[model samples]
Target chain A: MRARDVVITGLGTAVAGAGGPETLLRGPVAGGDDPVTRLRGPGLRYKDRATRLALCAARDALADAGLPEALDAPEGTEGGGGPLVDGLRFGVVVSTNWGNVDTVCETSATIHRAGYTATSPMLLPNTASNVTASWVAITHGLRGANVTLCNGPTSGLDAVHWARTLIAAGRLDHALVIGVEPVNEPVRRLVGTGGPGLFDGAVSLVAEAAPAAAARGARPLARVGPYARRADPDAAVAAVRADEPAAPARWYVPEGRPAGGDTGPAGLPAHDLSLRWGRSSGALGVLQCVAGTAELARTGQAAALASAGGEGDDGAAALLLLAATAAGAGA
Target chain B: MNVLVTGMGAVSSVGGDARATFAALAQGRSGLAELRGFDRSRFRARHAYEIDDRPAPGTDVPLRATGWLLRAVAEALADAGLAGDLTGVPVLVGTTLRELRSVELNWCEGAPFDAARLHFGTALRERFGADRTYTVANACSASLYALGLGTDLLETGEADTVVVAGVDTITESTYGLLDRVYREAPESVRPFDRGRRGMLQGDGAAAVVLRRGPGAPAGARAYATVRGVGLNCDAYHPSAPDSGSIGRVMREAHRRAGIKPADVDLVLLHGTGTPLNDEAEARALGEVFAGVPRPPRMTAVKSMIGHTAGASGLHSLITAVQALHSGRVPPTLGLDEPIDEVAGFRLAREPVTERGMSLAQVDSFGFGGLNAVAVVEKVS
Candidate 1:
């Protein structure tokens, strides 16, 4: 089978105070609104916060991709059945660091305080590490390849890369990629509250085969480009540049590292979403990709580079995003 | 490009390494024993398949799973002739409850632990000097997903060598949850049995060194070539296995491997012994191999090792690879009265030793219907 070109067609954000992708481009805002209220149907009582956040972001991404009818059907409806694309061909890849910590901690604490009898059976399913990703797939009727990555620092980019790999391998024509982190009491206890910037939200995008996107008449937000991983940021950038030489007009750097300061390519106008939205850990890379998409939308025909991993990380990853027009013109 | 399994390692209740574990399976040795990791008096199900070799005190690795993972990876690397050096190789670790036992210990027993150890990347990097690490948490099927991802990495030239591993230590929280979910805890796990009660948790860690076939070091023997892996979500129920989807994924695996169902010689089942799961899997198998002239012989290693959760997939895969190499099909221990759903398929009640077996398929279905199936061909 021939390799397929992957493209980003839809973007969504469920970050607190950030209404949508446009708001995220400006800067992060602080608010206390409940992200669960954004959900469309019942069964929210048993879901954990992270799952609820992922569902909201998934809904927004599917709707943005012109598949609003693809979700929110009553439970037991096979494949979110509607007059749209086949849910079987649409998969989901979620990246989360502290995703189900609340449920895990709470359940374990209950068992510790009382006995095994004290825990709720309804909550048992949430203890599975892939609970958040499963919920998103269940709600949206996405029956394709479902994967949840908890890889450190580079997980968000890894999730996106996995989605692209799935599409390129003919496993799925479209994939819903999500990066989520919730900052509840459990997370605070797990990671400690010493850090000033703690992320608490979800970011999602729809990655589809270019041919599929065109067949569905979906407008491509950006073309998924070359991705490379190396021991450090400099080598990662150079590796990706070797694959695609187009100079990026903007750069989204990794967490705790300043843009263009010892990290990323020197002299490129870099943006760090962590400064605005707090350190998102695993979610930072996807958030950076979201920010890059927004930047490409603002500046017509341009390229954006998003790099993740730094100190305490195993390695660094660099991903390139080309504007739809630029990609079409073979830039 | 082919993804060949050049080396393998495993540590489970039955054995300390892959060959030992395979021997135990061939001898029909059961690992289920009285739970000793925690206070068993509080729960009805007092048995688990805990590893015999406990991590020594004051070990640099804080978590038991981490230690087991390091051991498994070291054995695999050495088996692949890459011992003491993992400079440019990428490591992918899959788990359901990574370091959660540490969290539970800290929360309940007031044990000290660093929070950063929750993810395995740092520990793996510091220990083996791996260039990159990815930790996948797709519930029980995580390791197979990681295997699939690693195969893609090699196929796409992302890495010359990749280590795919899975590890999990039994945790009180999971035990409690399972105890509550099961109405009555059976004395032993009996996969595909009519009177099967449910599954018991286990401790295990397994790893496989996958190298691009063309780039493999000279004189390195390949155990098996990973033909393909198919992954999918049921998107139906969180705990229930969907037979249709299971059949679809199996067919998908066959399609990706460019083989027919009849070509497969053996099947390593997920077979958790839960009534619903066994029945569902049987129905899916019946459907998938309905047209095959001679359906593959099926066996459930979980019947012997207990469900290792995240590590179960790799454990089953390693067992399958070993079976293909040795031409021995391990028995699904304690399967007294087979379920009616698997009427046509051959369920091994005793170890079957036969040569010339060329292909095998491994099935791992996790919680939330996260399913993965892999096709492996013996490298002669």
Candidate 2:
């Protein structure tokens, strides 16, 4: 079972609606702003709102992959006795740009209003940037090697590169990669000033070894393509010394399951997953990674997910590129 | 890609070093006590988890606890056994509160943007030779992210040795703001408890040392190799977890680690005990392990120490490491009945001594959906 291209199998998360693709697609990409929310957002009860969004995208990606049952344990497995994916290796990747920061603002405000003696006295845990991921671990039960990356701009591509590295190294056969971003009131205040106009969004995909996916009656996604990243520009260029023009062109996403999908560039191969997801926010890179998984789930063929981003000022760009040419060309 | 966690150090409310701190915690001893750091006659906060009565440099008692951060760093460096020039070392320190010392000194009106970036590094040139220092100002995740960055530095070979520290002590503005929000009785902090009033704005600091190349101190036991870290932003809202992509961060961390969900045995949670945060973290955790058999046993670090925002994550993680090594788990001081919204898991309230997997995961979430998680395992 060649374990290079692990495929996406099951996904689930909470968002604006119930944990499902259909429920999530109901619109309002960026949550609506209400004055009441603004006033009480800091100490609001919907703290982990970002986690809800993450769960929704993950769930939808799994459904898009045609493996609704994957959520249930394998046959004869004791209470999900088997791993998310059986003999096939498995891993996970999740990314977010800004985490929970409002708590600090609220904590500070409360402290200022009250004296040192009357501060709101609960253990406020909104300090670390990985709170959402920890919540996910608590929600599910998966406990593989966990990581949290916060590189701005290149966040999405970074997640893919990390996953690609693990896959190429024969570490895991499959990985559930997810990308998400939560829109907080304070975030809105910073975006127009400089922070990218963030659209609180989330996306996920169950990536698996191409060979294993093909063997499991599951149609394969695109073959893994040439993946590279231009780390913190000065750092990458300084360390690597000018290499070949960084594998020219953006990503190419093949339309595997989504029927009759083709939206390739002005000049490229035919047959693509009419890819809709491309401009992955550095944190939401997990979503962009799923673009490839979504395509594979639909068209069913060997596909390539080319993810590359430039650091520091190059305005970081990435795509869930996919393309299916004569087999054995690059794979 | 192996990140080694060498020379662990911390300055919790209890002890000045790792071993001392761990032993104090293991004995069910608490560092919390009467409000001796500052004047609280008008307020009802009679108790606080404060460090000893050592006076700050040219300062009086009953003052804020920001000075502890500077001293803690020095103590951590001493514990790590590093002496030579630290010009090449990378340093990342986490602190949530805007300098209370600077604030009480009447600098609160200073540029809001630059206000949070304040650090003691610049003032002390000889300590850290100004190579590269960044302050991860995220709320609770600050220190954890710094620890995670330390691991990232080791993994990416960015720096031979990365010094990671988390400091946030009792401050007028910090504690004052928390007090205004709660306005409750007994002024206690409960993480993952139903009747939780809110978080206590306690002051504390913690630090650790990471070495990659030479200059390795003798027998500086490596508690765990920081395998990987995951961070994501919820563009949804600055305060919430951006429900949509909360779980993605965990998925990324696990993916990078080349491990699976079922392999995790310990889940050091950021259960803030507040109604909203508890539910949010609970939901996010449930989503990631949506289809698993036996979920990992969950524990909240904030229960023991009132949430030290900037240092909570690292503090929680260090506590988890101590528990893993001793084959015992700490109880959530106030978690009696689980919140209805939180399901599918059990807390190891009583310390359980046993060895299995040695894999543990710690999570820290900051404002603005800034999420970070680290997977640590006891070295083989």
Candidate 3:
């Protein structure tokens, strides 16, 4: 594949696990305990649980991106107000695996009580599938085009595909694509009986336009790899089981080896940097969306994105977001 | 008129199936009457298209508004003469209300009722046997949004012959809210009228099959070639669209379709008849079409059918397709006094002759400013 210049510029996150990206890199949030829970905020009343998670992530992401603080009403209100929001070319594309459970429950209740008209007018707008993206725009004063992709659990990566395609097509100068899922009673019950999709949170990444990232003297973080990858089930099981026989004290290899990975010099295409997700697989796939950018923010470039193994058919997802071959690990 | 409309569906108060529902709509019959879906005994004036008397399993769900959607989808596919496995085709559905009716079942009823499971995508996939199902929920404009996305998917080679369906039955929750607002001002919904009170709740679904490349049904032609679609968020309000942005979507659609405002023959307006909505729409239409001599002859079908929420745009598009097919544009259903805002627009009160051969445009704005506008051209 030809060299493609891509850099992460903005970040936002709202995780059920207590830690933000800073702590997230150090260790996994799930100590294999009960489900993690995010805080309930004033944002809940105006929007549903799913939306609350999205906003929380967007708040952190924008701040991490080093963009100006956001004003509730307007930017430049230095009267103890937040910094300026990001640019207009910054488009928004978010993915959600299960956004409707809460709203569905709400609408269902209205139907049961006084018929369908029993629904709240205030709540109707936010329940729509695209409301998450639209609300993001309204909250942050983003007027750019928005796209919300709902693809089962592949929502996060689907959002990446949409944003990356748009960027490659020169649609937006810079784009903020996010993946968010919120925990609610109905959804919790549904997932609890499920074989997968155990957790919920939001992760956003910035795909800076060529000029914008370069103008800021920002180095290219990682290659968006040719094809996005989802982990193989059998391989995942092996990784988890092999952990038992590993050295008791030594930390596992941060670099995940490809199945039948070549036995070569420690110079594999993605043979660098440490990758850590508190929870392995399943819900951890979501972290790929965040980790790719987080690594970029810290190491200026992470060699590869990996989903942890060992968890049940908890489908792990990873993309090789490696840096350009300037350090000599390329074709 | 080459654009072929092979299938159709609807779920409204009068009748859930397409044939029965469309007949009622053509006759200008109101679906709003009594409230049975929910315990609306407390409201001042209880009026809604409460879908009671569930249609038979294959017929229509009697007590459920979504039941109409179920029946409608069947009739629509049947009309198109497509019933066997639809495993290969993609499904693009626009819905403002989905198991939203289920919301009440969980919160108000304690836990989710068994009935809610029927509307889930997994169930729909099994029922319809489609390979893909992209459920779009975009408030009132959902149907149009689904259609818009379908057009893009087709253009991008994502799928061929995508089935676009949009439906929503006025749930007890939604109607109760409407009753409260309508109580503030009691009046019939009169689009483009000076005394517009607010929007009314209507239940229904509309389905359109879009085929790509040269492989349409034999001898069947497209009723309208979906040239371009413009979708945007107002970012101005939760339940309303931004006039300025709406104006841009109109421009962008035309630009993408390689046409100009002067080329439009008809403007299918999403006239919910609510004062705020009508005013905002009028202002947006005026701003967008100010350059044209007279705005495209604006006709609203919702005036006759009520606000169909998610399926409104698809219904409007179907009406446009029929108009293009018959060489006549239908008149507005209910318009008493013209709103001062729609000054430059021609509110068609009676069926009019088709003026241009080029194309027609339809607008559908959902709650939260989720807007969708599509350019439909006469099949060559």
DockQ of each: 0.66, 0.07, 0.24
**What TM-score does the first chain of candidate 3 have?**
0.67
What DockQ does model 2 achieve?
A: 0.07
Q: What tens-digit string does per-residue lDDT give for candidate 3 at B1-380? A: 11234566666665656556555544556566554544545454455544556434212232254455556677667766777456657666677666555544545555445422423344454577553455555668878877766665566555566788887776544555566545353334567777667777776777777777443586454556777777666666666667787887788778777898888888888888877778888898887777887557778777666788877898788777656665666567557768888876878666566645457899988766777788887764
lDDT of 2 by residue, A240-325 (tens): 22332222232332212123233334232423211232233434445434444444435544443333333222223233334322
List, in the given order, the native-contact fraction of each candidate: 0.67, 0.12, 0.29
* lDDT tens per residue, model 1, B270-323: 999998899888998888888888888889999999999888999999999999
Q: How far is B49's C-alpha from truth in model 2 (Å)?
A: 2.4
lDDT of 2 by residue, B1-380 (tens): 46666656667776776677777666555666666655565455566666645556334332234455555566656666776345546666765653433433332222233221234343223344533444445566778766765665566545677888777766544455455455474345566667887666556777777776333447565667777777544434435564445577777778867789887888888876666677788777788877779888777756666677778788877877887788767666666777775666767555555567488888887654556788887775
Sorting all predicted structures by TM-score, with the top scorer first, yields 1, 3, 2
Model 1 alpha-carbon drift over 4 Å, by segment: A1-3, A30-32, A71-84, A258-265, A329-331, B52-61, B214-216
- All models: lDDT? 0.84, 0.54, 0.58
The numbered model that scores best in TM-score is: 1
Candidate 3 whole-model C-alpha lDDT, 0 to 1: 0.58
Q: What alpha-carbon RMSD in Å does predicted model 3 have with respect to the real structure?
A: 7.6
Model 1: per-residue Cα lDDT over A1-331, one tens digit each: 0137888888888887887887776775556576667676677889888898888888888888776545436434643445446678889999998888787777777876787888888887788889998988887778898989887788899889889988887778889999999988878877776544688899999998888787767888888888876667778778777868678987888877843353345678767777778878788888988778876876774788898898567778889988777646222
Winning candidate number (DockQ): 1
**By TM-score, is 1 or 2 better?**
1
